[model samples]
Target chain A: MTIVEQPKASGTTGGAAPRGALDAAALRADFPILDQEVNGHRLVYLDSASTSQKPNVVIDAVSAYYREYNANVHRGIYTIGEKATAEYEGARARVARFINAPDSHEIVFTRNATEAINLVAYSWGRANIDRGDAIVLTEMEHHANLVPWQLLVQEKDGDLEFVPISDDGLLRLEVFEVLLHLKPKLVAFTHVSNTLGTINPVRQIADMAHAAGALVLVDGAQAVPHVPVDIEALGVDFYAFSGHKMLAPMGSGALWARRELLEAMPPFLAGGEMIREVHLRRSDWNDIPWKFEAGTPAVGDAIGLGVAADYLTALGMDAVRAHERELVAYALEALPRAVPDIAVYGPMDLDLRGGVIPFNLPDIHPHDVAQILDRYGIAVRAGHHCTMPLHERLDLAATARASFSVFSTNADIDALAAGLVEVERIFRG
Target chain B: MDDLYRDYILEHYRRPHNFGVLDDATTSHEGSNPLCGDRITMQLGIRDGKVAEVAFTGRGCAISQASASLLTDEVKGMSVEAAAAYRADELLDLLGIDISPARLKCAMLSLETLDAALADLDASASPAAVAAEEPA
Candidate 1:
């Protein structure tokens, strides 16, 4: 609470207009990329789960860093150098506050969430895990969350256990406890499934993992953009997320580990920065987050990410969430009506899922469906969507997915339904 | 519409030609675009140095299925050696549309399957050790 600063919203009192109330139609203007056409129709960009369209503020902020203040951080005593270092550290502080992190030093900048997980696997796993250790992962994790631990487990000759997912894409918590009984060294899983849209109980899982003496790491790439997250409240040791998926530039992502854990771990990469003193054979590492950040970082991207955090903060994550929850519920009902015999995968209850929805038209492959939808200028994702294990678990070859964001509306859902109707007419006629 | 050849693509997808498994396949191989899970199993029956029978059985997109459906007619009575030597671009050009670079693999899946089947035939005719080098 010491670091948190927000104007208390009196929306519930029915007096003042809701603070940070998200007006998606009006908010759409903030994102310049959304006001465009594709294939002679309005671009119904539904692939925000892949990467969010950048807002004007974020884009301008990124360019401003290069145009106004361009210098290497922590090196020169010149004005621009000092400004660059200040902006970079300022961005780090904003990111820290965004996730309710107690200290900015806990956040380590990486290329994306994938690299963040790889950092933990390479640095912390190498230090902590040994041969014959047990690691538990879920069946529905994106490859980013799954593969790094896999490399570590494979290297260590450790046992890797998967908490299986049900046919509807929900994690079987009973199986998770059974795997936990094995006394795994770590439990690495996604906060939300990219394909299935299943939102796992992170706090509960973290509590269970900690009780069993296992460290917990969450892949919050899908979760952070659409939902409100407090890593401290979740009680997870490590939280990884991407800036690109949250309306920032592509090269910005971060890892937020507990301060003590970061202090104890080794540097992920060795280079010009991230060092206290370097001799020919041996070099003393720098401080916590800087120790993990190796080279000249993506300073411009970090600036963009900071602006994006501010953008989301203004819109209010709770309102953004409420907007999506209503939009997705409408999509689930509206899609089946638009196209007969359409099948959607994930929990039916909106409480158990996020805005991402993966679906299929009967007998028509996901690629063909996506291709036809592309004609209508509706960009939806098709194929395995980097959740091959989850697809395999559900015995599905592929699915066509449309994920919503703050700018999404019921009209987008209607347009998607209409586009799907076109898909059905072409493939089913 | 939209300048794409979706009409004919849908036609072949709806009523794909020679889509049943061949009863007497001399060479058989399964090929898949692992990225999209587009699998095609091509079978050929060669007699008197010509392809006496040709068929395929699998599931995938309209382009992949239609591409295979169209190619079954092209190689039905051709010499087995000539069919085995079919070039990828020839098959692609025969599709009668501008295939995007992303979907070139879907349009050429049948040819790759044919090449794999021929490679399997080559390995079968040689020593057992040749089978060890087969593609995963």
Candidate 2:
């Protein structure tokens, strides 16, 4: 395979020659967190599905926001507030373009993907969803998407249906087709399974759901971080994602909905900055996105997310996708060889899935496997991973997970493979 | 790694203690740390108002399994009051290693589960009778 050079940092256009085909050594330098030692070995971060480590560029951008342009947005007449608002709204525009939303007004800033999903569940779901009206989801949804709907169903007396995944952990779209025939009011699913690493056929699902007159809400928390997504192209009613999963600081996320739908949905949270006018008796809500954002939003995190998006953008989503795909393929091949007893979860085909690798070693608990991996400075997640329903379907109590990002390399997979060997040896002894 | 990953912790994790449902449990409860996904199901056999037998079964990491084993060992033959007050610090101390604050719950799951069972016992019983049986 020909090695493609990593593009130079977008901020430093024409500063130096682009580094050669970003192998482990070159990519490791970009992440400061990977430099440190954990439990005596050099850190091998493999938990990007939970949260990715920020490059120096993203870290500096966040610090720069607080140090230089720290001010309240949308209200201040001063220069600082104006600058802050520009960058903050600029971040919104970047998010809009990143997902190819029709307009910036369609994007609502949120604390994280949890809050994003909650916004839609409360606002649109509360108004439109009714008693016995069905909200369909897949067994593979993370709790962030699942719990809010459960709460809504409890309150509104609605039925929550789950589309089952196949034995291989792929979404059983045949089951989804059956559910769609029932004419559900709304359909919600994860774009990628966080635990199984299955990339859902969301665009196809969206078309089917829309044709059946159901609104679709996609939890893009896992998908957006690993691949390029065009919301307009996907034709979903709402899409939600978190910044922290994409190498930005925590506490940043976005909820994008169509102009008509967002305008129709009620205010999720009602407080200052969200109301157009407030009286003791009643208050008029603000416009589409602001009505949903009640508090002083995560301003700096938003700015940092913009920088993070730019970081990936300069690298090109196609390149990022290609890099992570290679890493996932390497991991899938190496992991089985490293520990033959290991049971790899999710779809067997690399071409059909995202970059998360979840597996279980026989006779060893996932947590024990995770602890052993930690000794080798490999950061992997263990246990049910907030996908208890999916686990129930798979009949597994837990599985160890190693999720990859653009910065991850073949050597990181090698480290995970090596760590698994130690895990097996220790268990065998 | 200088044995920071303790051998005993690994041993218990590989071959967990009280790994199945107790045949004669007088009291039982299930507890889980939703954040880290550690789970424990504790079953107790109480004789004459003391913990005569303590056992637990569930899925978790090393710290949790070790903690359950250590907790069961510590609580055996102790009155409910004595076992309920088992400090979080002492459990880590018994492990002979420094655990992250996030993982502190992982090491304290059994104690918490046991505490909840004790609380249920108190809730179901008369207040005056429960107060009269307090441990010194």
Candidate 3:
């Protein structure tokens, strides 16, 4: 039975599926790549924060797209063409439904979340923001969120301000309120920190930004895969996320924006399929999303992403979130005990964070820790995790991050704990 | 078989050699690996066309710190010209460990810093200064 159709357990936080609700091993079985051995040991993948392993269904969906309905979208009137077009647009619609976007046309597929963020910063920022206007962001944002705004701020000669994170790694909302006093033209931030895994209160921040007459754009790349996100409920102007992080193919992501906002912004990329009437030099832009989606999209990847969404929906996001939370909770407690002097970053409160744990061992560089763990067939991401600014704020050069997905189990955490002991033995012994 | 953090490498990381600022440095340069945030400030006292003294101070991964420790030891008595021409492979040879491509930058940051220090010394001291001071 599909996980959503399974009897919903009514007890966890927000009625999140209990730890035992979703069978971890069964779900792990869904991902063919996770079953293999690495370095003569069972591959315990803790790098989902980087990119998730694809499930059989998602892999087959992409293969099936090229195998069967291989045609360009939106122009084919023939059977396979119509089928391809239907599938492509149907993927967009599925993304829209996944995020609870009011309209499917509001979702525009891009290469990845970085491209999605860049699309808004260029198309919307150029049109609306004037030179020297205040554009506020947080110190905790991934470089994707930071660099795009840096480019925009430079182009517009805009004043950029950052909302700093507190010692506990949560956003200083009061400080964000203080920055709103700048009456900023835009407030862009991440929904969850890629490094700290702190779940920013999107709705609260959106309310504050709206009160101060500013538009909010959230980098939902880390949020969409692990959390139950309803873009409507988040009440933000723009939401961006990647397909690769959520059991989908790489090369496919989406941008969800307010219909009116997308209607107003200029097209980001101009080419065929995004235009209505082409003259010698100029052409009328296509509709809300199509106008922005210039050239041919990654049709096969999009179909795979759509199936991935179905896979997640079938498993239910609440169960996914709950499953990861259980793993994180277990790791948070187990890691420090397993290896002394191990410092874990991000919130300790279960409700306040996602499954990411950026950490360090005394006198041990994250790179060394990761290298040692590799021998034990444990895959944890090390380094600044594309959040150099966040690392700077934390006074850390780099950190080893152990992030969890739905399929991660207590056994995986145990393996991580055991692997870390070996790192200590090699380095500290 | 490719055990990266061997005992000696870890020992170098734990108790790195000449890991302090040189107040008498003739030239100094700081090099960094932006990917891993490994920074090394290498200082050298150039005299009689030789590296009379060398020291480094920075924070980084074990690979980088240990590599710097080994590099400082290797270049302390080497001529300025030879130190400037210190190749990446030479440093890898001293490491005596197979550094995967990902950690190569970490392993090479030392040589990069030492080279930068020598370059800075060459630019500021001028070629004649080293030759003129060689007899003294």
Candidate 4:
């Protein structure tokens, strides 16, 4: 392994806080991976939209569950099994409380947010939607939220309509209101766009969709990590988010739907754990949430996710939001002045966006920009970001996206700005 | 300058050769790098089992466009059989840069599209070749 020498003036720590609210330097220490150097410079991770770096608490929680109580949940009668079952179920309860679900039984654990959306698309979507019915979506949805419904609508001979986004990257609410007249059965959208960081008006959209008699599903994969999300308060029928994006281990996420909706929908996956009794001819399902989770679930990761929720709750989501907003505001102001030809996408107003900043430097492809940034030990994502339709609409093949998390500091954004200068020097010089 | 984005790669990317559609091309194939949305379409005019003319048109990153630019130049006079037998490593070696595994597809996209166009030629040449090309 290559040992990277820490730069003397790396600015790994020591930044003035906006309101003395979030001590990002101290919080960065909690994540062991952030302490290291990359390519002779301090590792500046700006890919939280892909997956977040885990803190020691979440890591320890997962390891403790496996080390102390390693057994299958909801099955064995032994002491270890019972302990495992308690931890697994306890994680479900934590998820319920984290999202403000009406009942713990409404929270169903899946592999990730994608699987959770797929569960609703296949189970609830198949049962309710039929021929000539319409399902509404927005242009900014990640493929996870869009593709499943597309497949369902195609199979059921249903119409899949999309509400367009403006050039400023905000969804056209008036177009959505017009689409609601189609009497669609569902209206699904992302709470926060993974690429543009545009935060949709979830509550208002949900109310409009509800008035139109359409069920709402909010893809909160990007929202729950950076902002305070209350599913019940949003009044959405189904909400999905991933644990890995929230400082927990992968293979853990939750789908919080209405209890009546989950109870009425058929099981997405059928297996031993989800079935109460199985015979050669037929079988009976377990319950609302259990019916959705089949086979051996990711128990340890769920426990780790529970610990992650506790960590976020301790820090408080409002503080996380405030910290990121400060960083993003600094970035939005700094990037344009630092690189004159830089073209940034999404709303200029901070209230209309989140921590993700996707932009393009003049005369440089996003891939080359990313490669050059990698040399400066600044990691950023460069691709279509699984929202190809949005890219097409924006008339861009790809853009360099730098996303922030709780551990992100203004210093990291400074590194990103300096790194783009290097990109300009290398590409245009 | 970075080793991957060498002067030659940048020159080829900025002023690509044979980077327009052939109106009278005999065969054409298009492919896209789904990860980055880099697309390339290769057109070939074959005569007497050799590539009489070749052209390409698409939008992509430096690596992919340069690779396509370099590939059309290399295969202009080569036989269809030689182009079909072209290896991915050979193309990477021609580029003369260390490519990460993630961007290997970008560097090899032109070759894949060229191979597909050659396959299309083979399918059009004989009925037996069409049967052979079909997956079992």
Candidate 5:
């Protein structure tokens, strides 16, 4: 019962012409998964916030790395090993440039953004944070950014405070100031809320935290894929993001920190390649970045992430931002109009949000909504989105979220709206 | 109507039967599907070795809520042992729909909670006898 038909092209404002700087129709072709059909309908993937579909270039890059020159990096003297090493290090350089970090040596490869935050919490928090110090977080942080700090503060006998979010889902700056008055040792927050899509003022927060004698760690897992992030310009000590959220393969992510901080922090894990000299009972750790990256890394996936970075650079992040904004604008207007009694979470202003839209219909559970949408071949995320505290704050058990990417189009939004109508008919009729 | 969300499913979901706590409950148990945030607290009133009343309170999707409704109706007059031995397939057959593997937990949550309540009864009757029945 597969219906291989072209997507509907006559339903929305962006249907007749390209809405933003990027031509979404042309860009959507690059993702082969978008061309297929599911359950007698064209697949409309609105779950990019969970993980983006890889482009052909990223797929080819990873395949070519394995098929052409596959070898262990940093140890072998053969040509293949040297090539692999170059590609692996080249990825770190590309990621460093992508975030405009001061030095490539500041970038450390990690499993994902969660692991990156854990690395900072363990290697940096244990070294500097004392028993009486405090660590401040935000109510909107995902578990990846929240749990590690909670565990760290618990272990160090320090206090953990959260800056509450307002009714509009924006962080209350006054409350943040009050928390800052506690003279915290470190302040960690998400650059964009994965559940609410609220974009925080990163540079301003970083400045305030620095003035309060605290280091800043920004979880850019939801920001780096949709917006231009200059880590040095933002004046943050550490910025972490995952590659899978940005059209790259999983098992590849980077944590960008100041070179001096990386130099001072102990190695997160002890194994080969992270040590300069080993003895029976003691060992001298390696230099910056490699000191954090112990044992063999995901070389092929890193190269694929480099290609993904190159692809985004080639497309220009400003254009990507513009495209997603238009899609979100269309969604914010279209979803509520199509389905009655819909409640949307997060800031209503377009400037304050990213591509993620979390919402719920009256008396309809999010899982049921997602299941109904799935029948139409429309994919969406439904749950607490790993922000249970925020969901509790909002008085909701869960929400249905539709996050956009560069390949998303107005027709996809139309399908989502139309699917909600079906959901309404099924439940309310 | 969709096969999974049939008319009866929606009706039961909108106005679930026996959807509250039993004040004189003899056995009670709670279960949760953490992945989807579906939760159920099932309570039973037993008299003369038979199930006298059944009630459940929770929030979840249509399948879970309606399945809970159907379970309470089916178990109201049954004995404790019969309710404990009830299989999951019977509930699915009673629902008259095919549930995807991803949603199997939602459909089986009520049964699991009911099983837990029966297990609690078994545990409280004679702790040493139940402990000795275990194969070490």
Candidate 6:
């Protein structure tokens, strides 16, 4: 049975299936935050790009863990600990299945996608980057993806090169080809620009990187939450994403690497749970994922993530993709009409992008626009959005962004537009 | 629009203050808040230990621009010492709104730039007097 048939457990799961899949109205009902008013008006949440609101199922699943099976795993022989361990590992299996990885052993739980990317940089990058070598990346990466490689190049004596992006927001393939010819030791790029919402062609990029004799890491933070991902199908060497973006709690994410690649990579941090035996001198590391994990680990958070995955699974990825696409098209069509002075960033066409829309009004500051929207109970993100390098390329100091998700509706966009009208009036005055 | 951090801030934001070169200005400095992509360049026309005129121009969020306008209002006839000692917290308190920690820097970018401008003014004055005393 689809998870919807089960008792409504968490925020991420509840509205995924209407009678079977929950409609927008029903789904919004499950998110407690959506029921409130932001300013004097009804809340119109549009900042899913930063983080999504949880459904009742995702939240209850997290709370349920603390209430039920809250214990340290692996070390304790007690019942609760064993239950926690099973749930945690079960979450790993769920993640492996979600990405269609060959083995659950490849999934390493992390604090967020940032830490996941850092793990690869500190571990594999430290061992591999050599003098005169090059690390190819794109100009569209968030600081999380870019800075790690910059640090790697700094410490390891390699050059960090870039592949340019088009005005339409897609990566330039010809430029990528030229960068590939450099024979970089590794390639890293975001699967989607969290700010611009440009979805990169990961499968093709992965193939090109592999052909160039470079290991590929796709920052999947924006991609994972919007669509279903199959890592084997994409053929990427490493993929990283955050749980919070997918409606799970904060302080949770996973990095999926090929089993052989992870096995060869060194441990990220050396500490408790990750060690098999501890002598004062030298200690042998535990196998695959645990070796990389290093600490007590986020047990409940991991399980909550599993619940999020299950929530997405039951809803069906195609449906989520369709919903977001519809929302994007609606915003693209409607928001501009509402505020004629606005200039949107990223692809004008929805087909080349995810659901984020970053734009600016002619005279009003994005911060003012966002504050005005908040007064109308409409939420949006304003500023650099942790993608300073990309914005620098665009010559934009900052932009206000409105991102959509499954729970978003046409009405929310309408509220957003009405708020934008108010912003224009205020600015014009 | 009458809000303290509202229109006047947007006015300076849209058509920035002192937007061009100030060749005769005693000092000028630029400050950047990389996290939020806020940048400000403050120029001070100083005369005999007082800021005769202060102007700024840059791109950023409303808080940054509003803070810049507020800085101009706060520091324009004040001595370099007073402008240099302008506290980020006091400026934020003037906004009368709670802002996230991530945005605190945006509101202070212009103030920091003003501080740097004051130092540059002090430096420029020291060199001019030394040259004047040296028979040139």
Task: For residues A236-349, write the lDDT of model 1, one tens digit per residue.
Answer: 999999999998899899999999999999888998789999999999999989998888999999988877876676666777787889988999889988887999999988
Off by over 4 Å in 3: A1-20, B127-136
Q: Interface root mean square deviation for model 2, in Å?
A: 2.8
- Across A348-417, the per-residue lDDT of candidate 3 in tens digits comes to 8989889898899988888988988988899999989999988888899999999888788999999999
- Tens digit of per-residue lDDT, candidate 4, span A327-402: 9999998998889899999988898899999999875779888988988789999999989899989999899999
Chain A vs. true chain A, TM-score per model, equals 0.95, 0.94, 0.96, 0.95, 0.95, 0.95
For model 5, residues B1-136, the per-residue Cα lDDT tens digits are 3489889999999999999989999989999987788989999988988899999999999989999999999999998889989999999999999899988999999999999998888777787967888899
Write candidate 2's Cα lDDT for A1-429 as tens digits: 122222222332112224333344665677788889888888888899989988877788788889998998889999999999998998888777776677989999998899999999988888988998999998989999999999999999999999987889888788888898778999999998999888888889999999999999999999877777777778899999999998888999899889999898888888988999999999999987888888788899998887787666666666677777888888888999988888998998887778999888886778778877887899999878899888878988788899988778788889999999998888677
- Candidate 3 chain A: worst-modelled 10 consecutive residues by lDDT: A5-14
TM-score of chain A of 1: 0.95
**For model 3, what is the C-alpha lDDT against the true structure?**
0.87
Worst ten in a row by lDDT for model 4 chain B: B1-10
List the candidate 4 regions with Cα displacement exceeding 4 Å. A1-20, B47-49, B125-136
**DockQ per candidate:** 0.71, 0.35, 0.72, 0.52, 0.50, 0.50
Q: State the local distance difference test value for candidate 2.
A: 0.83
Residues B1-136 of candidate 1: C-alpha lDDT, one tens digit per residue: 5544467877898899989998889989999998888999999898888888888999998889999998988999998789888888888777788788878888899889988887877777687746766776
Which model, 2 or 3, shows the larger lDDT? 3
DockQ of the two-chain complex in candidate 6: 0.50
Which scores better on TM-score, 3 or 5?
3
lDDT of model 5 at residue A74? 94
lDDT of 1 at A250: 100
List, in order, the clash count of every candidate structure: 0, 0, 0, 0, 0, 13
Expressed as tens digits, the lDDT of each residue in B60-134 for candidate 6 is 777787778766877778877777888888887766556676567777787778878777666656877668668
TM-score, predicted candidate 6 vs. hidden true structure:
0.91
Clashing pairs in 4: none
Better of 1 and 5 by DockQ: 1
Error of 3 at A2 (Å): 6.4
